[model samples]
Target chain A: MRQANLEEETAVLGFLEAMEKGLSMKVLSGGALGVVERDGIQFAVLTSQALLSLPQDLLAGAEAAGLPLGVLEGDGFHLDLQGAALVAVHTKAQTCRVTEQAAKLFLYGRNVLGDSVVWHEPGLKRGDACIVCNGRGESLGLGVVVGPFKGMREAVKPVQDLGTYLRDQDE
Target chain B: MTEPDFPVARFAAGPKIREWSRKHGFSDWMVARILQLTDRPADVLEGLLHRPPRYLRANPLRASVEEVLSRLEAKNFSLARNELDPNILKLRQAPISPGATIEHMQGLTTPQDLASASAPLALGAQPGDIVADLAAAPGVKTLHVAGDLAGGGLRERGAIIAVEPDADRMRALRFNLERCGATSVVMRNHTAQELPGKAWADRVLLDAPCTGEGTIPKDKNRRHGKPEEVTAMAALQRELVDAADRILKPGGTLVYATCTFAPEENEAQVSRLVGKGYRVEPLGFDRVASVPLVPGVTQWPGLELDPSVARARHFLPGVHPTLGFFVAKLTKRERAI
Candidate 1:
């Protein structure tokens, strides 16, 4: 969870730096602090909702524009910038399953251009769900990218008894 | 709007907010109360409350800041330094029992209000001089200046007199002083004005008690209080600053700081000091200008002070990403023999 927030913060800082340089872009997906774009570079902001929710086309376009992309892998994620890039992902948790489509696009783009990319993977754990796919089915295999939206959120015990929740599997 | 009776419940309902509240070790109810008072977007509040607490660099004269932080981080705790006080830190990872920590118990680290740290940092204490931390309960800035003076060998001639009005807090100050290994400090427990040793020092730090309007982040009750209550505190602040001028030696520096946003307590108090023939010194606004100096109060609405009143420093968390505070630096001109 913390790693997700940091990525969001770094992305926002980059976006603001870009904006200060006179780039005009509207936030396409996510809330107030989401990524904005000028010509085609997709950038993220600290307060915006996660980029995983972005439309597939925009995410791919952002990748092509030389825009830095933060890909959520297992528990943590990877941050790709122009000259200098470092990855900060959770090492404790297992990698989340990424959609085959996202996996191909993310890896291919990096491999083809192959700029200097610094990978930081931290605090990864197993059994984490993909932020985009939400673990309904295996849309994406585990450990494709790095960042949050893959960490575990255990169910909190009930503070108040709203009666008992009947299990679907139980008779 | 009147405060809700059930603040704790409100805080626990939201996952992000609850996480932050827990991280800071704030009571479930206190967390809820703070969130209710803010006009900020939900995410911002989460960031402010749950994001890592800022770390404070302890003045070596006061305590072992680096060592303390390392130990705490080992316990899964994190903190951030206050933007204003190089010595004051906000805890990001709430300690199960922060006060009981060896460093805290040893007075090596103090859990101070972020706004409280701003006042002294704005004062900008220098080496080779006498300094006073008036209203120096819990001695956060006193320790800050001590740490700065460490290894400089400036204290051979200079002394730091940390004066607290309350007896309990004065003891707290002493404990911190001992833990930080600051030996050159003198602890006095008396209302600043009533203390017999007036103007005996070269520099004075008055961290006056105010209505604490700016302390809502730490003390949520401040928001629900009446404005007149604050006004009353402002009146008292003026009296304290007036007394501060009397105690500071001519050519000595005096820093007036408060954790409240009330102009009456901030700019107005500084204006009163400037009127006393103290040459107002400008406090630095850039990031590198660390140390506890007051950022003068010159530009807020309803202030009738001089246009050149740059001696005061005003800090609002909303503006500076920290707590709300006001500070001003003034140098008492040398009196003719």
Candidate 2:
């Protein structure tokens, strides 16, 4: 694996810390980190390569933090509640509840618009990652904040679902 | 373009290929080279005109082979296991587009060509082995290596260093790696030559860029390539192969592959590495059942290749159900210093 320089390591650590603070939940601490650029958009990718080699103490710390530690597929990490890592996050992380109609669209790989959001955890800003769920509280998938949570239908954009990769026709 | 009135049965292979190239919109030089490379020029030409079957690799990191199959089958998509690689599934029919399926969205499966998938399998990377994939952009093989490293678990200790020179391709590579849940990979937006020499790997896969003669059936634009382009590609491939050799530990495996029918880019290149002390390891075709693998040719008209080149395997599009590909497995030997 390509070793990250000290500066990169610090920047990645800072980003993770900021994400944790923003989401008010624990996030991935140690893993193989790399930068991916597309259409001028850069994403920080954390792979399980480093996680698998982590010492027992570090692994324990990640587990305690309730950070979802699954492998990143395509270009994004997927969160599955069936797995132990995501199970902790599902119970602890803030969730945005959507109606049954929106849940179907969301699961079918569509972004969740503000009009579809029935309720969301307060303090979620644009770009914050959160768990998306149905009114029944079943976890649908992970989504990133794209617009503020306001009363339904004020053109409040939508959440960028991590599963968008699946819906993309272009490979 | 006017069609040449050459009779298929009466005319020699050269005339027949020339006539076919004129009828179809292919360059005469490509047809002539293909004829020299294969006995069944007509079949090869026909194969180029037809579309190959769509293949999807079941990502073991996300779900079991059984689960992925069952999910797709339930979605009304007809599927069958690939004869060569069980992880690869051929689509017979689909109620919806393959890419738009919930299974794909969930990262349980990925669309990949059979020949492309074979490169990583040939490497035989065991769990926890350090593997390097040179020219990994649009990283399909890198993800395959990562899946093998994961050992059917959600996580594994193996690491893959993926190097891609092009920025545009690197973006796609990162997207695919992330979507496939290939978390064992570390992608570098740099050429293979930029990798540190001191940090060697247990296995290295150099799927070098070439003239892509074998992919013409899928992409017609490849037929328009000039001869000088082949020479330029061979030069780049030489540097990539040399870099792969440098980063491979002694006794480590290196699988060199290309999606082209050029002997210079395939056999001649492998032969040069063989002269540099790498031992040619014959590929085990028994695992690759039903696919007719043509043994590598050692005597291309102008090229005097080592007889050891015969150890490499060639998949002709007309013969194999997939695109044309040449795969040569070599082992970095301990120097006799």
TM per model?
0.51, 0.77
Model 2 docking grade: incorrect
Model 2 residue B249 distance off true place after TM-score fit, in angstroms: 1.1
Evaluated against the true chain A, what TM-score does chain A of model 2 have? 0.46
Off by over 4 Å in 1: A1-171, B1-59, B62-66, B79-90, B94-97, B113-115, B151-157, B287-303
What are the candidates' C-alpha RMSDs? 23.8, 8.2
lDDT of 1 at A102: 37
TM-score of chain A of each: 0.19, 0.46
Worst 10 residues of 1 chain B by lDDT: B1-10
lDDT of each: 0.47, 0.68
**Candidate 1 C-alpha lDDT tens digits along B206-254:** 8888776556655655545554555567766766776778778888878
Model 2, position B67: C-alpha lDDT score: 86
Question: Least lDDT summed over 10 consecutive residues: which range in candidate 1 chain A?
Answer: A160-169
- Backbone N/Cα/C clashes per model: 75, 14
For each candidate, report its DockQ versus the true two-chain complex: 0.01, 0.19
